[model samples]
Target: MIVADGIIELDNKNKAQGSGTAGSVLVLLSTYDSRVNDNNAIHLKNDGNSGVIYAGNGKIEVGNGNQIKEATGWKIKLKENTTVTYGQGMAGLFFTGPGGSYSLVKGTYQAK
Candidate 1:
């Protein structure tokens, strides 16, 4: 769900498993119209790698030692060895937004 100028509240957490697992949450907030806040967010998939980043032009603020992790989306199966994915992939999470904004990107990206 995409939201603007709204608040997000999550009290508990559940183990996620599926595509687009590792990702992030973008917080676009600007203060005094001078301090612009533009952060790309993306959720990692179950089979995706770590330290992936997207492209966006804006200021991104994050807490100390806070990083994005792989969080997939799946359904509960009653049968044995059953697979049910919500058909969500990296494009669903780290999709190309206004500027290719995404999450699940590693903090310390190596010089490349």
Candidate 2:
């Protein structure tokens, strides 16, 4: 999982490869915009693997020759020649229940 508070800019020829038996899952979480500039900018996949990119409150722009499994954002722009294969069993992984809540872990925080 790649989490960013701001923009995530991926240059040309960048790869976020994954490996495993359950296949691989690459999760890109950003609070701001994520961009892939130029052709061949990113390759977010491994054979038969599942990859997911999520931009919480921002947009995602991908360049040509890029490959991915799935992507979700406020706005998504894809250049020519980009490839995306939506894999199976991916729906359950990103499900958010209604009224979900979070609580802080006890004793994990330290005062500065």
Candidate 1 Cα outliers beyond 4 Å, as residue runs: 6-57, 69-88, 94-112
Model 1 whole-model lDDT (C-alpha atoms): 0.28
Distance from true location, Cα of 22 in model 1, Å? 11
- For each of the candidates, give the backbone clash count: 20, 0
Worst 10 residues of 1 by lDDT: 70-79
lDDT of each: 0.28, 0.61
lDDT for 79 (candidate 2) = 72
Q: Model 2 lDDT vs. the true structure?
A: 0.61
Best by lDDT: 2
Please provide, for model 1 over 6-105, each residue's C-alpha lDDT reduced to its tens digit, 9 standing for 90 to 100.
2222222322222444543332222111123322232222221222222232222222222332222121112222232222343444444344544444
Q: Count steric clashes of candidate 2.
A: 0
